[model samples]
Structure formats: C-alpha cells, structure tokens
Target: MIPTPYPLEEALGIGWYITDTPGTGGVLRKSPEDFAVEEIPLQEPSGSGPYLICRLQKRNWEHQHAMKTIASALGISHRRIAWAGTKDKNAVTSQYISIYGVEEAAVEELRIKDIVVRPVGRNQHPLSLGLLEGNRFAITIRDCTAADTAATVAACTAAAAVGFPNYFGLQRFGVVRPVTHLVGRHILQGDYEAAVMTYVALACPDEDEEVRRIRTEYRETLDAKAAIAALPRHLGFERSLLSRLAEAPEDHAGALKNLPPKLLSMFVSAYQSWLFNRVLSMRLADGVGLDDPVSGDRLLFENGREDLVTETNRRLVSVHLSRGRCAIAVFIPGSEGARIEGKSDERMAMILEEDGITAEDFKRAADFVGLRYNGALRPIAVKSEIQSGVLETDVSLAFTLPPGHYATTVCREFMKADPRAMI
Candidate 1:
C-alpha cells in the first residue's frame, strides 16, 4: 500500500499521471552528434486572419512575458495573442502563436532583437482555449557530466521500450494559495462568491474540514469559530476574516481586479475549478487511465529501424514522437530506484467507510461543471543515491498508464510515497 503521506496538492508536484494523449509521439530523443546543425527560418505567412507566432531565445523568458514583449513591438493587446502551449523558461523555444485582427503588412513590422518571428499562418477561427493536443518541445539539455552519459544511454533505451506518463507539469497548481489565482479572477468578473468557493473546493477535494469550510464560507460567514476549530485554538483570530469579506462583496471583488494580470489569471482559474474537478471526476469514471491512447508503451524509431509496433504488456506507456517531430529529454532526479510507500507527508487522510460521493453523482456534476479528468501511470528514470554519497543504482522505467493515473503509485514501495493528492 502507498503511504499517501503528503498533502494531495504537494504530492502532485513530485510526479504526474499523464493526463492526455499525444497527437504524435511522446518521447523524442537524439544525441549531440545526431542533432541537426541548421536553423530553419520560419516563412512569413501572406494571408490575413489570426495567427500565433514567436521566435524565443533559449533562456530568461517566460511564455507570457515573451508574448508581452512581442506584443509591445507590434502594438497589440496581450490578450489578443494566443499560443498552442507554454515552453520551459530555461530552454530555447520557437513556437507558433495566434494573432487576431492583424493586417498582413503589419506582420513583418513586428520584430524583437533576439526573438525571431518563426512562422505565421492565418486561421478563420481564433484558436479556442485548451485546443492543443500536445506540445512539441525542441529542447537541448546541457551541463551533462562524464558520469551522466552512461545513465543517459540507459534511460533513453528504457524510454525506447517503455513510455513516461503525460502528467500536467508541477507548475499547474500554484504554490501556497493554490486557489488564490482562481479567486482573483472570479471576484473581478463580478462572479458569485459561491462559484469562487466551489472552485477552491475542487482543487483539493480531500482538504480538511477547516480549510474547506473557510474557503467556501470565506465571504459568507465569519466568526472565527471554524478557523479556530480547524487549527489550534491559537489561530482563532483568522475566523473573523470570512465574515468581513461577505460584508464587502463589491469592494472586495473590485480590489482583486485592481491587482496584477498574473493574479487576475489565477482568479479566473478558481472560477474554472468547479469545472476542472467535475471534468476530472468524470474522466476517472471512464477509466481513461487504464484505457487507450494514453495507457500504452511509447517509443521512437530511427530513420531505418521500423521493426517494433505498438503492443500491450501489463500496463506500459505506448507512444512515440518521431525523431524530428518532437524532442525527448529525460529528467533524472538525484536519486535513482528510490522507492516510496505509505504515509508520505503532512496531509492526513482517513478512508471513509461510507460513500462521500458516487460515480453517478460525479457524472451529474461533470455535466453541470464542464470539467474533464483523465488519469494515467507516471514513470520516472532515476539514479538512486543517499545524500552526500554516490549513487547506489540507476533504474530506468518505461511506464504504461491510463489517464488520471500516476506512476508514483508503482514506485510507492521504493520511495514510500503516496497518493495524497487528487482529492
């Protein structure tokens, strides 16, 4: 059994149960010698409509930040720009973006020094939200040590045989006030407090009574009773805050709107939470985690080697992004073969003998909220080492998982980790 120690929120950070299927392959790997040495200059699209485009450097630029820079150069609202996906801030990312209501003549005028206007294409429809199937990451992992090469080969070979989970990256759930971003959005849009509260509730369904009650009644009730009860008596002062907020709805929401754009995005995310949870719950019911597309072993084939085909073996990730189609980089943690099982962290969970919520209830909620959830197995290739010592072993695993699944569930024995999140 998994120890399931950490708060479900924090536990999600360590690993991912791949959530979606790759339109193409999942792992794209190549050695330095195999890497193509040329840069392809993106062609300027001639048509007029909406297009998302960017030529970003390998470092020092977050996705939205880079877009703002490009927008300033072109004299357009940042809101009008769209991207298929976000790239890591530390890597060189040349990706396509969508621009709405821009003229063809203005395309060439938009330029930034290090940023290249990679490619531009017109679409009749603005790219809708969450429209991307997968992100094609073209990355170069540097700072490899002499010892890293052998491990890299082994990891790559393992991936060739097994696939990693397609989990939502760690950054999905923001730190500390995870739902703060969502709350901010709802307040500014003049949304009901209940809607916002529902959003926070979905984030960590298994959150304690104190946390849940405080979040839901944050603007409706304030007496310090709930907060004091939730924590130690010393924290009694926090209870009055919820009542105070209920007294200042217009003022409070207005105050949130006055905050920065990032905060604003988070606020909107909260309003979206109810939907996120509802959908997530429904996807789980369908068993997407143990089913097709996302639940198979994935691999890549060199230009000439095409003997292997997709097959089922127990439960393994089965997908491959072609060599030139996608970039595959393995994230090798400091420890390899580190196993986990049982009570892992700060969060506490008590198995409810009674059904708190049922599958049928989840379906009704999903339809009402418009949220989607898919779980799957998550696998990691690691080299284990005790702190201040050398590695004990290097183990690379190809994980086959269904949607809404986590690979850590398999590593529970070694890491003693748990399924604390997904509440």
Candidate 2:
C-alpha cells in the first residue's frame, strides 16, 4: 500500500507547516498551458524487450481517456497500456507509457486527440504504478504583480529550507464532487445503499450550477431513470450506477457492484487519505516537528539504509536526520498492522475517535471485497526544489518533487488563497 499524492481546496481547515507566512494573491490553472508536468521514469528501458516505451505529451486529457484512445488506435485492450502515474487532465503532461507486445514502429505511427506519442525506445519491462523517480512541474500563476511574486518567492525559500507538510492535496479526493470519502464511510459501515446514494444523489455545494441542479433532483426523487436522463454523458460513472438502479432499484449492493472495481477501491483509499490529512494537521497543531524526530515517532530511511527510528538508536537517528536521508513517518491506518506507537499513537487514536471509527474499520468491509486498507507509512514533510520567475502579472514556478508528494501542496504554501479560487 503505497501513499499516492494528489490535488486541494481550502475547505479542509488544515494547518500549515509555515503558518506565519501569508500567501500572495495568485491564479492557477488559468489554461492548460498554465501547468506543465513531465514524469521522470524510474529507469530507461533496455534495448531488447517485448514492450514498447512511448513518451507521450498530452494536453487537457485524463489518464483513463488517453489509455482508451491509445488502446483503440493500437487495436489492443486497454489493459496492455501501462503508465507510471496519473497526470492532471487540465495540464500539459509528458509521461511514459509502455504497451505490451507493441513494436516501436507501430507506436510511432499512432495518433490520438490532444496526445503526441513519441516512441522513446524499448525495454523488457512495462511501466507499473510507482515506477517513477518523481515529477517535474512548470506551473504558471496569473493575477500576480511583482509584489505578489516577491512574497511567493519568500514562501518558496522557507519551504526549501524547511520542508512543508505532505498532506495529500485536494486532488486525491475529487475536486468537483468531494464525495469519495463520504461514500467510503458508508461502505465501511456496510451500508451500500447510503454509499450508492451518496455517490449519485448528494450534491456538493461547490459543484457547477447545472450539476448541482441535477443532483438536487436525484436527491429528492431517488428516481434512477430520471437521474440517468438528467445526467450528462460525461458523468459516466454516475450514469452507470443509476442505470443499475433503474434496472433493480431495490438492490443497492448490486448497484454498487456495477461500478468499476478500481473506482470502488479508490473510494476506500480516498477515505484513508482524508484521515491521514487530519492526523498530519493534528500532529503539527500538537507542536510536533515535521523534520525533527520525537521519541516515539517512526523515521523511514529513504536512502538505501535500514529503516530506523529514534526509539532506541537516538545517536544514529540524529546523524541521518541532519543529512535529510530519513523522514518522520506517519502511518495511514489500515486494519491492524501499521499503527504508530507511544505519543504519536495517542494522536492518531484521538483522530480516529473523532471520526467514530477505529483501526478495525479498515479491515475488509462487509459490502466490498478487496477494499481493505493494508496500511503504509508516509513522511510528515516532503522537500521540493523550486525556481520562480516573473513575467508581469504571471508568475512561473518550476520544481521537482518525489513520488507521493503533491505540487498543489507546494503551491498552496506560496499562494495562501483558497486553492479552488486559484485554480
């Protein structure tokens, strides 16, 4: 269970690593050109291999959509195409895609909408999840003056010197609906009806006007047929759920089962990520250092060293701490295996209590199979190398971050405005 970092909004009321630094007013994602991302592959494919490594530069295209397009163009199943990570749909992203049993020539000949496939070479391996060193980003923030640029640079300097909280950004939880965690809670409680209803009917206040109207109708009537008609074609998942309900109506479990298994799994993960954000915020509020270690906190060695904490070997931990080779680890709670110990454990327990859930709740849910969280440790803080340049009202930021860290999290620190407002 690896921690995945994704996007943010200001609705969480979360604390910041450097709370004293107020953000400068800025705009983000004004256009697809505003955010550019390039994935740093874990390793280059060897010359001889069965897989074709393709470097694709896609603009305003989601990963799933791109996969479908590539699969269709190549006349292959979608499962044959693999990528290291999911990139933002509203950005220009360059990533490596490895297709099984495809030749370099065929890959080069392929063309897709808003996507340019550049055959990089071949390797014996297919790109798998987490098979990336990190990501490089070039983000342009508009509506900022020179003074605002200076303030942003100051924030960046502070973050580079002392790391920032690695809270999963608003992207992990849906930016449009923010319902994944809500649905997950119902699944954990063994209430498939509530989960299905929450996903389909509960309208978020932040949603677009037309979407809010349609959701309101569904919420009031619970008429699957009508909802399906009202929903746009882009709302494929919602329509799928509603279609199942229109057929069975009474079998909530069946309706949930109709959803893609990957999506159902994401609901559980989104819930876990939300809880992690809460715990990390609490840790900061409790005066815990993001970089420095406490007696009970776990320290994961990112380098090729043994995983060691300050519990027993304080002297050794101190050495690694100075070198930034290790991180203060926080567990994203699962069924049982990875709970933190001592003082940090108490903080997590309190957080779980607030949510009316315990570690046991993370075990396989009665309604969903294989949706259990096995748990993993995430660092409290993550580092990024940021370079800032200004062109009148628009400010450009370039940086590279390790896997499991969000660029929006870094941007939030500099532009302290509501994340949604910036985007």
Candidate 1 C-alpha error for residue 220, in Å: 22
The lDDT values for all models are 0.35, 0.75
Q: After superposition, how far is residue 58 of candidate 2 from its true place, in Å?
A: 1.2
- Write candidate 2's Cα lDDT for 381-406 as tens digits: 87776788777777788889987688
Write one digit per residue (lDDT tens) for candidate 1, span 203-296: 2454555665555553355333443355433222232333334456444333333333443453333323323322332333444432233321
- Report the number of the highest-TM-score candidate: 2
Candidate 1: worst-modelled 10 consecutive residues by lDDT: 344-353
**Model 1, residue 302: displacement in angstroms?**
23
Alpha carbon deviation, residue 185, candidate 2 (Å): 2.5
Give lDDT for model 1: 0.35
lDDT for residue 217 in candidate 2, whole number 0-100: 89
Checking candidate 2 for backbone clashes, the offending pairs are 7-169, 7-170, 7-171, 8-170
